[model samples]
Target: MIGETFVLKGNDSNNLIKENVSNLKVYSIDSVRVKHFFTEKVDYIIEGNKLRRTKNSKIPNFDEHVVVYNDDGTFTFNSFPRNPPLTIPFQLYADYDFSDFDSIYGNLDKSFLSEKLKNKIAKREKIKIGVIGTSITAGAHTLEQFYHNSDKDSYPYLIKKAIEKLYRNEVVITNYSQNGSSIDYLGDVFPTALKDNNDLMFIEFGMNDHIYSWWKSNLPNFELTMSNSVDRFKTHGIDVIMVGFFQQNQSWDLEFINSTIEYNQSLSNVSKKYNCYFADVNKEFSKYSQPKINQDFCGDFMHHPTSFGHLLYYKTIIPAFLKEDVNDGFIYNLVN
Candidate 1:
């Protein structure tokens, strides 16, 4: 395999092909294809960890791009000067088989979604799923619009597809999440969020809610807002599921890490009080609390997940949608 690794200076727009190479195939993290077939010279722009593309391109803003290197200095992107730049490492590979990545175990726990709702999906009926919360739900690492169906790999998108595939149903999943959103902010956006009558609603705010400068100092307010959201959505006859947020060891300061753990506990309490399904991905990562393992699953050091991490989120809730066991695998019984 021809492999290239480089550091992308944030906010810089540059051509990746400094010299010339033959038959280049570029891919992003998680072995997601960036350029499947490239015979001509190619270039890229970066902002933070995101890759900037043309207006009509489907590529996302960041995750790390991969490419083959024939440049004089080995694998590297020829970046131009930026007003300010943040140095970020990237990797590119030719004919990568993903043999070196860690194996992902399918472990979906019991779901708390109502039986009636479960039956509807199991029968391949039509359903609408609405998701609200933060950047994670907004397709952070999945890189919305990058590929025609890249977003399908995100948790919400995967949940919809898994239900359809397992139950033979048609599912419509809507994402109303914004980057850097918190519980209180989500509450403020309630009117727009509730405009659609969703069969199932996924709430993800733990990452933002745990921010010390944001919700941690105002813990009571955070709890009240999230509680109100659960009540309001349930009142609207929508089956509510609270997404337990995901984070890694190196993602935050010790203080913020403590707050994140506390916030997840509070989410568990809220789920019990409201009798909702808590898709606790945070708890899943508790086993991987060590920095090495956390980085293995998470794409960024924080909430942005690699494809495997996203799969765990999908597992967190999709099984609950199934009426009976598929009998195809043992991951069906992973209970937390």
Candidate 2:
């Protein structure tokens, strides 16, 4: 491995990179190849536990751009920034190998989307997308207080941006996802969400749907509601993509984690029964989560995941539309 990586939660008010970065031998720092690819010593000096930026360096300041970073044990800086600048400094790898994403997509059911995506790309038709879920699906992030791009950086928008880039289809997203909502809440807006006539729909609800105290009893209702919602869309001729949501650090209780796993199974069952697209991102999240020494995608250490988390969400969902040999360097171009 090149070196251990980490993400700082955010930048300090002064020129300091907060968090004890003294232990992390950070060789590179950047956000979406747009801002400074900072070099240590040359860019800033490490004073005690904090890394400070040089006064005159080209490195983006909080005013010009968002300071962010993420990896393992390093500061929890995650998510790539967008123009107008968003997210903090992320430790980006110019030579990152996306081959690992192959395994992330390996468990997905692609039989339903290949034809759909190919047809859309061939005709060059416009795509309308609808996403319904709880906060995580709604693009809830800690950076929203400072930046407004978190919504644009969510998995829903990420998937929308990716399809537009790869298929050349003009994609428009109508995200009805809200924070703290349950499967029952989606039931309330089912009428309006279905009216969009979307070419694709991304549904994520396992997190909020889970009844922490009575998860066992709620499984049936969760499955029923999700199935009903998906059925309504499918019946209306809309293609749907569903994934199992996983919590990082927030709920590690054996029973709680088990409830989430059961919820994932419910999602799998529904997707299989409806013949819709499904990706088990819970597996992918595990591949990078802690005990392996990497920053968790969820920046809050709870609900809202940073851009890196959303990136994982996008990679897992888009494979259903991609082909066996379509992997490329240009595959990821999500900046809208």
Candidate 3:
């Protein structure tokens, strides 16, 4: 059962989209059943809003299947039509798609960060950047094939590279992030991570905390734990940057739980109470998700951001990391 795929119904198929291939037609469908298979690609053909594949296509012959929606709300796959309805769970190793935004959203509370970490980056000093939290900070869904390179694709590494480029400094990045870990487990990992003297530390754990703790009605304990973590890091002169993120799951029983938006507000409260910086990456991504323009920001619909989504993450925090005012319409391409 560990390596099995199950149907997650009444969910958005946007995040499952492999990528937009120009030659393929687009369709819309409900429900997504996913499994991971080691195939180079997946194929499908669009008939109205339905998807089916042929035998000649390059997608592997797995017993599972995953249907994805493109950025423009269309469906695409590389293979031809395959008959016989698939009952077993399947994996889809799809292509690359970027989330697009016409404008930036959210405000970066940089007042504290400017007085603390910006100067260190500007002077090219040896700054140690520490990051802690879940798979998002650990660089999930960051495949090199889709992005330019490893350094440019990941959020932590990108922030490291961006600082070096902007400040020409000798910077070091210490990632204390563990995949699928949350704030409740922070105490377990904190002592070991605290051994290092990090100039600035980023705390990112809303996704998992919401999935686990928020659903358990443990909101008070979750906030207290987060606050304590911030206080602990601050005691070491490690400036903190709290990250609020975007999620793409439709099957998570969102109506009954405290919303990610509200969770982000709680994070903002923590940042304010602790005099730390807050980067509301979720607010920016929500611009598209709200209107249903593009939903592929979270490549896997849990926490992993695509390459473009990663840019949105770093970009929101970049202004706070710098001393001078950054242009609002700025765009970052890793290749340059």
Candidate 2 has its poorest 10 consecutive residues by lDDT at 92-101
| lDDT against true structure, model 3 | 0.56
What's model 1's overall lDDT?
A: 0.57
- Report lDDT (CA) for all predictions: 0.57, 0.59, 0.56
Clashes of each: 11, 22, 13
Which candidate's TM-score is highest?
2
* Candidate achieving higher TM-score, 2 or 3: 2
RMSD of each: 11.3, 9.2, 10.4
Residues forming the 10-long window of minimal summed lDDT in candidate 1 = 82-91
Q: Candidate 3 residues 1-336, lDDT tens each?
A: 011111222222223222222233222211332323322123454332223444454433432344455565434332244212232212232322234323433333446764456566556679887888887777765444223324345577777776677668877888778877877877876676677778888888877766543454766677889999989878877788888877545433332235676678888999999987788887776655431212234444444665556666877776565555444333353213
Query: Which candidate would rank higher by lDDT, 2 or 3?
Result: 2
For candidate 1, the TM-score is 0.64
* lDDT for residue 273 in candidate 2, whole number 0-100: 91
Q: After superposing candidate 1, which stretches have Cα over 4 Å from the reference?
A: 1-111, 143-150, 213-216, 249-255, 324-336
Ranking by lDDT: 2, 1, 3
